[model samples]
Target: MSLIQTDENIIAQMDSYMQRVSELAPQIYKRRPVACVNTFGCQQNVSDSEKIKGMLKKMGYTFTDEPIDADFVLFNTCAVRGHAEERVFGNIGTTKQLKRERKETVVAVCGCMAQQEHICDRIRKSYPYVDLVFGTHVTHRLPEFLYKRLTGSGRIFEISNDNNEIIEGMPLSRDGKIKGWLPIMYGCDNFCTYCIVPYVRGRERSRASADIIAEAKQMIADGFKEIMLLGQNVNSYGKGLDEDINFSKLLRKINALPGDFRIRFMTSHPKDCTRELIDTVAECEKVERHLHLPFQSGSNRILKQMNRRYTREDYLELISYAKKRIPEVSFTSDVIVGFPGETYEDFLETLDLVKQVGFASLFTFIYSKRNGTPAAQMPDPISREEKGKWFSELLKVQEQISRAKNADLVGREFTVLCDSTAGEGRLSGKTLSFAEIEFEGNENLIGKFLKVRIDKFTNLLQGSVIE
Candidate 1:
């Protein structure tokens, strides 16, 4: 709804800076620059940080473990929860001392929080030690921004509101060797009443289907065993694209690719998750059996108030359909308790839904109002104490369900790609259904998918690898 304001003159200047960096590449290579990126929030922010690392690596800047030791420090931030914002401010405040210690250090802040105009203005007034402030849209131009800071003087603020630009073939520094996050789409069109995503992330725009398929093939070739398609709403993948493709078609194509890897996706809205999509997921051998469909509230009244566009009955019907089609499939969902005007009866309805669905796991949160959203302006009659009670109750119910569901898999064997080595001969990985499982194995087993027997359940599902 709100577009980022930028003039042609500023755009030209940015382009010119990039050109100057390229022309002066030989001279710039004398000193090795080190950068440190501290990321917060969701998996999407992690993916963005990987891209930032990639761009910086391309610019001949190596990474550092300590923010204070690095010549350039960047905070890739989040604004979803209030606590995450508070942590960012606290970290940035510490950077004031880091800047004072080394005056030449370039301290920057970017991501969803930086995209907010109000946040940017506040930082400019309060934290002048920050050398640069950018946003989600201009990640590809980090080298240019860095060059301007190095070759010139003063603070730089360039937070672009528009996210429509798609720069392909950007370098990436991924965290895991066996698993990777592939973003099939960018931004959100569904402005949920309590969400700040549409305001910060911009409109929904999907990558070309062919481009996605190509990236999948490349990842497979690069030895990644799993790829989770990341998006705000993955079900609505090819909405405004020129091609007549949709998410179901894309899954079919990816599954058909010759590979031994697993395919997964996240954050599906029950409203946009069509029956065809569920059938496709069931039929695709590579597609995982775990689904993260978020049902914000069970009360139809609260759902209407949030503009979720679906009823409790609709969600249950969809779950019933998916389970019948793929009986082994597991369901996970997000629940927001104590929304504006949520009643005791409404809270009971939510608990009832949790009982009926028996979700493998549920991410429950007490609703926190975000600025510039419809729910923020609504009359929130529910008090913090009442919300806390609801949150605790939801967690108790879901924990019992999760434990019992996991308890069912006590003797079952599932394939696990060893991804991490916990100390003392323990290796951690995940099953095809996205169940976290750790087993006793050596480092040599890392990156290999082996059949593991489910032995126990503690903080996470435990198992022993079978030859």
Candidate 2:
């Protein structure tokens, strides 16, 4: 079968659960109204929510931000971290209160968290008021799920199956018109002990190169200036290729597409980051100079315990590669404090690494044990107060480094594309290095890249337009 047909078949199978619901409920009644979708977790989840919105809009439902004002409430949730799952549970409980207050409103929950068997069982048992529960693969089936629920032929339905298919031809209502999100890969195969993404999102799968390139070309045709590639682990892209065309090759291909579009990718694993990938990133003019390489922990002991498969020395070498080839390269790292047996020395190792690398920014967090992971079963005896202490220490150091990085931008010109709201008579966009900057400009300057000479940097983003 062709790609589109294969995709449609997978979507059909995912929505098959709704057929059972339809047997009990029926489609005679007709009503369509506004819905609010709450998204949790990473950019991938946000992209999925957009697809859900596109599907709902086709079904004659308007979008609303306020849940109370919306006719239907849907949650596109994440299960990567324990805290995120707790938040989903809390939201579900609150929605139950909403159903009590307003019996007519329909409540639905979908996304990765819905793929968990235990979570699914609880939602079916305790929250019978929920109209539907769907998973990652069935985003295109929202219409069918809603059709059965509204027509009085079906009760609640849930779809939580292991699916690996790429869907196309759905309308996309993007969050930002200037910067588009392009998915090159999905799911994770690494299965790090501290992560639940592998279990919920399933194995790694790469989209066909032709399909991805075509989609990106259309985005460029529509005047999008920037494209951020989305994936669980992007370095593993093109592993599905027969001739071994990797992400670096993809970068070169997209860069030579005869457009001025800027390229960016997120959440790279230090393990899969290879010499070829480094060289491509360093040399490709179209690829941005910033990298988001996530080094979860700094201590070799803790890293081994977490099954990260890389030592601190290995990470330093990767940093060395970037430093020599792309001297001005800025990097952002993910740091987790208070893992199961993290000690004072371990925390110091993290601090030392952060200082050694002088990261552009750090997404620091206190570890929250995910349920199904091996790390969760390990003794997490660290107190909340201790975790907070470690987190505060990490934050203080990262903030200083970030402030210095931003401050150094002063007396330099950066190419920024206008996107978000700027102050009165001003525009806000990101530097090619991903630094957020605020600058004043006439309305005509919007949507186009302009050279802004940084007049001031409060260690906060403030730029002045060149006269």
Candidate 3:
């Protein structure tokens, strides 16, 4: 394994950059500066973006929604799939003219895409005008990266080749004033053959539980009401540490925190979804009654091929156990259709499992090949047309499930946490079950909760807010 996949080495880099980053802060504030961040990929990336924004703000830069008006444009990119890569490349190309127009403008690229050797190679060769590059691990070092860009000394600042470690004290600008993403852990230890996370994010290293609680406490003090605990694999949190704390224990600890905030986590592997964890989830009042368990494929054969480390029966049992323990508990899942060698019957099995489980919502994707994954080299690949057809079929069934689930909320009341801006005339938010709710309210309702009654819904969504 690469040294970048470990923890000890990363802590050293943190101290190095923290000292340098602070020294560079005053320089950025001296100039008339503006920054724009274009993000792609997961909640982890969103959390990274929040920190990036926080870092830039500390350096006295304002944000702009338009790239053309900005003095500094940063592409917080993703390489999770081919389509995401294409979008970033397009954005970079389009931004090139803006850089040429304003020769002093700092153009940089960062995120998981920066971790890949090939992706970095292309950026260096074809996009030399790009002043700075960094990765997931180097988000805290972003201030330093930008510092270099502001001066004439700009070059690629990607420190992604080093080992992974938890960088405490990184500030964040929460997207929602009332909600925040708290990372319990970072990176992945599971090298699922189709995944580039372990390669790009490097290995699993957990933050100290004490630090996590301190952050949560601070957020609570700041009056935040909802916190989503983010991780590539949340269940694997604390297992990599010396303290021997498990995820369930962490959840229970947070639930017992001196606050009324709701707690949520994501992307659990079925192999690690133990009865204890399920029971703990059922018992914790603060823990939301929703779980985002990603079943990449339904067929045991295909699962084995993806190196999922669990059989189909194992997943079904876990689902059954979780539902039994918390009947009111709803589920959302990640499913990939048309994986390599995935027969029609295999696809049907996934459909069957989805219906059997009756997920509150499902995030479905067509199997897009990733360059460095083992599944990428496999023979008998699913064709684009076949993948498209399968995706459509999967969407049809999922839409039905979603509609039925939303319908069940009729005449029922739910507590929704409002985060986004109100639309033309109504407020938009998410319920505890992660259901989308749009209700009428004043602008002041944007960062608070409302007891909402399901008033009506279209074929796609629900309408709400208590009388």
Better of 1 and 2 by TM-score: 1
Across 1-467, the per-residue lDDT of candidate 1 in tens digits comes to 21222245544654565456545543643456778999999888999999888767666678887987788899999988878898999999988888888887789999999989999998999999988898888876777778877786578898876547666666688877888999988889998899998888888878888878998998999999998899999999987777888999999999999978999998689999999999998899899988999998999999999999999999999999999987489999989999988998999999999999989998888888898899999998989998998899999999999999888888899988788898898999888787888889899998888999999887678899897
For 1-467, candidate 2 gives per-residue lDDT tens digits of 22222466645653454354333222221344667899998999988887777666555567788887767899999887777788888887778777788766779999888877788888888878887888876666776777666666455556655446667666567777788889888778898899888887777778777878898999899988898889999988876555457888888888888787799998788999998998998888889888899998889999999899999999999998988888468899888999998998999999999999999888888888788899989988889798899899989999899898888888888888777667688788788778888887777776788778887878467888664
Would you list the rank order by TM-score, best first?
1, 3, 2
Q: Rate the local accuracy (lDDT) of all candidates.
A: 0.86, 0.81, 0.80
Top model by TM-score, which number? 1
lDDT of 3 by residue, 1-467 (tens): 21213344454654455456456544654555778888898888888889888877665667898999887888888878899999899999988899789877788888898888898889889988888888776677776666565555758657555646566665567776687899888788888887888888887777878888999898899888888898988987786566758899899889999876888897788888889899999999888888889988878889989999998888889989988898578899999888889988899889888888889888888887899999899885568898889889989998898888888877778888877765677888887778887777787887777888887778634566764
Indicate the residue-level lDDT of 221 in model 2: 94
- TM-score for each predicted model, relative to the true structure: 0.94, 0.91, 0.92
Native-referenced Cα lDDT, model 1: 0.86
What clash count does candidate 3 reach? 1
Comparing 2 and 3 on TM-score, the stronger one: 3
Span of ten consecutive residues with least summed lDDT in model 3: 1-10
Q: lDDT at 157 for candidate 2?
A: 59
Local distance difference test, candidate 2: 0.81
Which model, 1 or 3, shows the larger lDDT?
Answer: 1
